[model samples]
Target: MELKVDVLLTSPQERAYHTAKDIAKLQSLNGTAPMLRNCEGLRSRSLGDWEGRLAAEVRGTPSPPDAEPLGDLMQRGSLGQLLPSCYAAQLLPVPLMVEENAVWNGYYRE
Candidate 1:
């Protein structure tokens, strides 16, 4: 598949930079190579006091009664606590499902 991109919003992270470069290459093949830049507003929110901790340790512990609620975060367009989980989802454009008894077929257009 050919993805023609006009612009790409990326973070300062190395992986994000590489991914954007690859996409720009593909776009160049089509015609114009859009500019890729980082935006501070696009950066993910900080975890505050929960930067690094296991799920078990973090759970069952109250958030000091001052932390933002999950629903509130989503309402504010932040996704806050769910950010990590959403990262993987962001890399995936579609869900890939596999079944033992299922057979799939497709055609390669390249």
Candidate 2:
């Protein structure tokens, strides 16, 4: 199956940007590459005080008081200003989940 990209929207984070760039490059291999645009709303949710803590330490704890709510983050992705009109876009910050899980299973194993 071929995926068609009109515009490649990405988070400003290094990892996300790089992954998007690589995709853009692959698209170029076949035809004109899609334009890459950084979308702030695509960035990972801020975990507040849990930002840099080990995964095991934060796994079962309550969300931090200052953390951004998941609903708010979802709303941001749908905001008119953040996304172009009549375009296909789905914001999934899988990296956020992967990072913690990878840390738990790889680095902070019990």
Candidate 3:
């Protein structure tokens, strides 16, 4: 009987960067080599004002109606009303999952 091993591959951004570095090092050991292929179509979204802040801190304040959520701010076209260069490019995680207080109760007078 013969034994075989199967391997799975993951193309995470960090993994790709390290792999490229290792390849460069190995090539240098031998001699000058051609440039490694750069990872194309790889984009990282900016954290904006909520970068270093904790979730608990942000949720402590009441969200205003005009206040855009972290997700909308991170998106591209969402900011076009204020900036001309704004455009949607990638997806970003929501910063605040829960709000401390509801912005509107939607109650109407009879």
lDDT of 3 by residue, 6-89 (tens): 111112245554554554455566665324332222223334565567878777666545455556644532222212221134
TM-score for model 2? Answer: 0.66
| TM-score winner, 1 or 2 | 2
Q: Over the stretch 12-49, how does candidate 1's per-residue lDDT look in tens digits?
A: 45665666677677768878877665433233334556
Error (Å) of candidate 1 at residue 44 is 1.9
User: Which pairs, if any, clash in model 2?
Assistant: none
Q: Considering only N, C-alpha and C atoms within 3 Å, which residue pairs clash in candidate 3?
A: 76-87, 77-87, 77-88
Residue-pair clash count for candidate 1:
0
Best by lDDT: 2
lDDT by residue for model 2 over 1-110, one digit each (tens)?
77656466677677877777887799799998777767676677889999999999999899999999988876765535345322335442221211111211011111
Over 4 Å off, model 2: 78-110
- Model 1 whole-model lDDT (C-alpha atoms): 0.46
Output the TM-score of candidate 1.
0.48
Question: Cα deviation in Å at residue 1, candidate 3?
Answer: 29
**lDDT for each candidate structure:** 0.46, 0.60, 0.33
Against the hidden reference, what TM-scores do the models get?
A: 0.48, 0.66, 0.24
Tell me how far the alpha carbon of residue 32 in candidate 1 is from the true structure, in angstroms, after superposition: 2.6
**Runs of candidate 1 exceeding 4 Å displacement:** 1-3, 64-110
